[model samples]
Target: GGILDVLDCTFEGNSTNLGRAIYNEQGATVNVLDCSFDSHHSSNNKKGAAIRNHGNMTIKNSTFSGNQGARSGGAIYSEGGAMAIELSSFSGNQALFGGAIYATVSPSTMTIEATTFVGNTAAQHGGAITQLFSNLEVSGSTFKRNIAQAEYGGAIGVFDSELVVSDNVFVANKDKTGA
Candidate 1:
């Protein structure tokens, strides 16, 4: 109902129906610092293999790798509220939609800075990130070797959202639609 803080934690080989590593519900806030999430997996048709936020979340200096989500958001997912991510890394994540991160809901706001995403893959769109009806801003990040097996936006995909990207690097990303 309020706030939760996590620091210097390691989550390995976690499996769950949703939010294998962490889940923040509505009206709550979560702060994660210097954490590591590795080899997390969501159950069949579930979303958010590593972390899922429905309220407010801040992540700094975290690492997510080898996570798998059956539906979307292999590394992280935010459905509502505000989120801030900085100095984080995501690699080798896989999902049906967003391989690394997914943000949805009209009133949601997100900001990502100084992050790295590499070798992520998605079956549909947005091998790195996918947003829908949200306000998003990304800066000083790097995306490399990400792939979308079908559809467009190997690095990012937006649907009915306000997006702002600045000072980011994209390299060797592939998508079926050549985006």
Candidate 2:
């Protein structure tokens, strides 16, 4: 119904069943800028330690670190709708899948630019990002020292998704297969 804007905020050590710090339900639009989410946690089997977006969302100039999701998306998750993130940093986050971001929306788009993901860990796939059944565009990003303990894609994983990647760098990312 309306747009919510959050700026220059800090969310630290928050814990919840889902979306420990921020949750945007359907039909809501949110914009976050110059914020930090640190040491947030979601309960067991939950998703999104810092942000869970089922609506339209945009985040810029943000930082997420030491966040944990028991299931997926240690920092951010998008089940539907569109999301855009720019100039963000994700570090030391952990989850079962998608240590940094999980996007699983059909007929929706997610765009990320000029971001950095480092030292994130996932028990399964995508130590940094996972995109499933969605449209994803990533550019001018860097991923380093991320680890996927089980499956493929230590830096990123895509399944039944459309992905466009450009001007990105991946270094020292490790998985069961290799770095």
Query: How many steric clashes between backbone atoms does each model show?
Result: 0, 0
| Stretches of model 2 off by over 4 angstroms after superposition | none
Over 33-137, each residue of candidate 2 has an lDDT whose tens digit, in order, gives: 999999998986998999998999999999999999999899998998899999999999999999999999797789999999999999999999989999999
On the 0 to 100 scale, the lDDT of residue 44 in model 2 is: 67
What C-alpha lDDT does candidate 2 achieve relative to the native structure?
A: 0.93
Error of 2 at 100 (Å): 0.8
Error of 2 at 176 (Å): 1.4
TM-score of each: 0.97, 0.97
Displacement of residue 95 (Cα, Å) in model 1 is 0.4
lDDT of 2 at 48: 91
Error of 2 at 130 (Å): 0.9
Clashing pairs in 2: none
Model 1 per-residue lDDT tens digits across residues 1-179: 99899999999998766647888999999999999999999977888999888999999999999999889898888898799999999999999999999899979999999999999998999999989899999999999999888987899888899999999999999899776
